[model samples]
Target: MSFTTFLKSVPAFRSLATREVERLSSQCEPVAYPQGQQIIRKGDPGDAMYVIRRGEVKVPIVDEHGREKLVIRLGAGEFFGEMALLTGEPRNADVFAETEVECLVIRRKPLQDFLHKHTGVASFLTEILGRRLLEGDGIRTVGKYRLVGELGRGGMAHVFEGLHPQLNMAVAIKMLSHELVYDEEFASRFREEAKIMAGLKHENIVEVIDSEEAYATFFIIMEKVVGTVLSRMIDTRGVIPFDETRRILSQLASALDHAHTHGIIHRDIKPANVIIEESGRVKLMDFGIAKTQKEAEQEDEDIVGTAEYMSPEQALGRKMDGRADIYSLGILAYEMLTGRLPFDSPDPYEILRRHVRDEVPSPKLLNQRVPDDLAELVRRACAKKPEDRFQRCADIVKFLQQDAPAAIDLSKARAKVFTVIYDPEREEQVTGLFRRALAEARKIRGARISISDMNRIY
Candidate 1:
C-alpha cells in the first residue's frame, strides 16, 4: 500500500481528507530498525510517533529494580508513542524491534501543523487518545473488590484503596503494575510477597487478607490501616518525644523479631512503610523487597531498599540475615530521635557509600536531649559490623524497655501541644502562619513545636 493509503487506514488520521493525508504522508520519514534494536527507550525525549509499516515491535516496561516485562506487541498498521508525542512528555515505555521492522515516523512540527490545519481531525484524534488512555491498564475493579482511589505507588506496584460490596469493608489493594503481569519472575515475586505476609501474623504487622489475579493483573488485598504514616509524623512533628520514639521502635522490633523467627528478612524498613494508629499502634507494611534468609544466601546480588535506611551489608549487596533488619531499625531509630538521617545525600550512591564505610555520628550530638543510654544503644545498633550490632530484634526491644534511661530533664524533652482554631475561609493564611512558625521553631536549639490539631469554628 502507498504511504498515503496506509496513513488513511490509521485510526488517528482516518478523518483527514485525501489531500491532507497526502500532505502528512509526504512529511513522514520511513525508517527501519534491525531485530532486537531499541526503537525508543523509556525516559528518552519523545520527538516523533511511529506507525509500524512492516514486521513487528514489542513494547516493554522496565521498573526501578531493572526488571522488564513485555507490555504489548504491535504489528503492521499499529501505532505507538502518540501520547508522549502529543503531550511532549518523556517516553513511558521502551520499544524494541521484534524483527526487522519498518515504521513510518511522523515528526512533531509537521504533525502539529497538520493537526492545526485540520480541526475536525484533531478533535477525532483527541477522542481516540482519550479512549486509549482510559482503556489502557486503567482498571477500576478487581474481582469482588472495587478500587476507589490510589493510596500511593512504589517501585514494583501501585496501591489502591478498595472496597468489598458484600462485606462492606475497606481494604488496601496492592496491584502489581499492569506492565509487569506478563513476566513470570515478577509475578511470582509478587505472589511470594503475599505468601510471606500471609504466613506471618503479628499485631504490629499489616495483615494480608487475600491475593487474586483479576483484569489480567495480580493484586493483594490487605487490611486498610486508618492512621498517619510515620514519615509524615516525623516531617510535621520533628524529633519525636523519647517515650514515643521508644514505643514505636519497640513495636517495630517485635514485628521484625517475629518475621526473623520465620526466616523472613524485611529488606526494606523505613518510616514511610510504618503507619501509626491514633491508639499508638504501629503497623509495618510494604514487603515488596522482603527476602527469605535462604534467598539472601544465594548470590542474586540485587541491591534493593531505600538508600537512606539501607544497612551496611545491604548497601554492599552482601548476604544479609535478621541482623540487617536490626541495622535498618537502628537507622529508623536515629531518624526518629534526631529528626534527620545519619547519612543523607541527593545522590543515592553517596548515601550507600556512607552506610557501608562511615561511622555513624552519636545521636546525642545531633539532639542534646537524647538520653545517654538511648544514644549508646543507637550507636551499637548501627555498628558497621553485623556481629557487633544487636543480634536479635528482641534484644533491641529489651534494651529500649529496660536499659534506656528516662529523659533527665522532662520539661526540656516534653513538646508543648498547641491547638489552632480558625475560620475555614482563612485556611491559606493559617497554613502560611504555621510554615513561618515551623521555620522559626527550627532555629531554636532543642525547641520542637508542632500543630497537634486544627479545629474549624463554624
Candidate 2:
C-alpha cells in the first residue's frame, strides 16, 4: 500500500487535514518482510506503529504451558502497535509475517509533526480520550473515615490517617481516588489485587490488615508507618549516606524478593512507595498496578506506570516479572545517590523513549562522590534489556549490601514537626474573626466546620 493510502486507512489518521497527511507521507518509510519473519517481538521496544500495506501479519501469544496461540490476524490497511507507538511502550504480542508483507512505518517523529500541524485533530483525539474515560466512574471515595489528617497522596490513591473507633485503635486506610474507582475494570482489578496481596505474608512487606467493599467504596486497611517516605527523607537529608541507603534498600530488596517469590511484582517501585518508620522498619506499599508474571501476560496491554521508574519492557507493553521491578528500584537507587533522575524530559513519551533506547549513565558521572562499584550496580539494574539487568531483586540487594557501608537508615530518619505558638490576645482575635467567617459561611448551604478552642489550634 502507498503511504497516502495507508494514512487514509486509519480512522484517526483520516481525520487529519490533507496538508498534515502530506507532511507525514513525506516521512513514511516503506518496508517489506518475507513469510515467517518477525515484525515485532513481545518484549522488544516499539518505535512506531505499523500499517499493513500488503500481505498479512499474525499476532501470537503463548499459553501458560508454552503453546503458541494465534490471537489475531491482520490484513491490508489494518494497524497494530497504535498504543505502543503513542506511549513508547513495547509490543504485547509477537507479530509475524504470515505472507510476503509490505508495510508503511509511521515513526514517532512524523506522527508528532503531523499532529503539531493539525490542532483540529487534537480536539478529535481529546474526544476519543473523553469516551474512554467516560467508560467508568474511575476511582471513588465511597466510604467515610474520620478525617484525622492527610497522611499522603500519590499519583493514584490517597492515604489517610484514620481511627477505627470501634476497635479503639488507629490505622491507615487507603482509599482509591474517585477517578480510579470510576473505571470499573480498574476498581475490580484493584479489589482482586487486595485479595491477592492479603494472601502474602512477609516481615518486610506492610501487612494488609483488612479489605472491605462498603457503600460502593473499596478500602484497604494497613499498618501505619510512623516515619517519613523515602522521597522526603532523600529531599531533607540529601542522598542517604551510602551505608545507610544501602541498608534500607537492602531491606526493600529483601521485601521485594519475598513478594516476587509469591509471584507478585511491584510494578511501581519509586522512593515514594518505600516507607521508613520511626523504629527503622521499612515497609512497601501501593500494589495498585503490580501483577504476577503469569497474570500480566494474560491481560490486554496496559501502559499504566510512572515513566521515570518504568522498565524498558514495561514501557513497551511487554510481559514482565521481578526484573521490571528491579529496574525501577535501580532508578530509585540512582536518584537517592545522585539526587537526580537518569533521564529528564518534559514529555512522558520522550522519557519513555529514552528509557527504551538510551543507556543508563553512571551515577558517578553526576556525583563525583558516588563510588565506582555503586555506579556499576545502578547501570546493571537499569539496563534497557530485561535479560541484561539483574536476574532478581535478591541479586541487587546482595550487591548493595556488599558494596555500600552506609545504607539508608530507616530508624534514624523521622518525620519533622513544626511547632507554632499562639498568644492569648491573638487567639481571642482569631476566634472573633473565625466566628464572623463562620456566620457568613453558615448562610451558604452544605457549609461545615469544626469548632475547637484557640489554644487547641496551636
| Candidate achieving the largest lDDT | 1
What is the C-alpha lDDT profile of model 2 across 59-155, one tens digit per residue?
A: 8768877688546799987777654433466666789999999988768655555554443333323222222222342212224344355576554
The true-versus-predicted C-alpha distance at residue 49 of model 1, in Å, is: 17
Using all chains and alpha carbons, the TM-scores for the candidates as numbered come to: 0.62, 0.56
The most accurate candidate by TM-score is 1
Model 2: runs farther than 4 Å from truth?
1-149, 165-167, 298-300, 404-458
Give the alpha carbon lDDT tens digit for every residue of 390-444 in model 1.
Answer: 9999998888878544445865566565567777898899889888887567545
Q: Give Cα distance to truth, residue 416, candidate 1, Å.
A: 15
lDDT of each: 0.81, 0.72
Q: Please report, as a residue range, the 10-residue window in candidate 2 with the lowest summed lDDT.
A: 124-133
Question: Residue 163 in candidate 2 has what lDDT?
Answer: 65
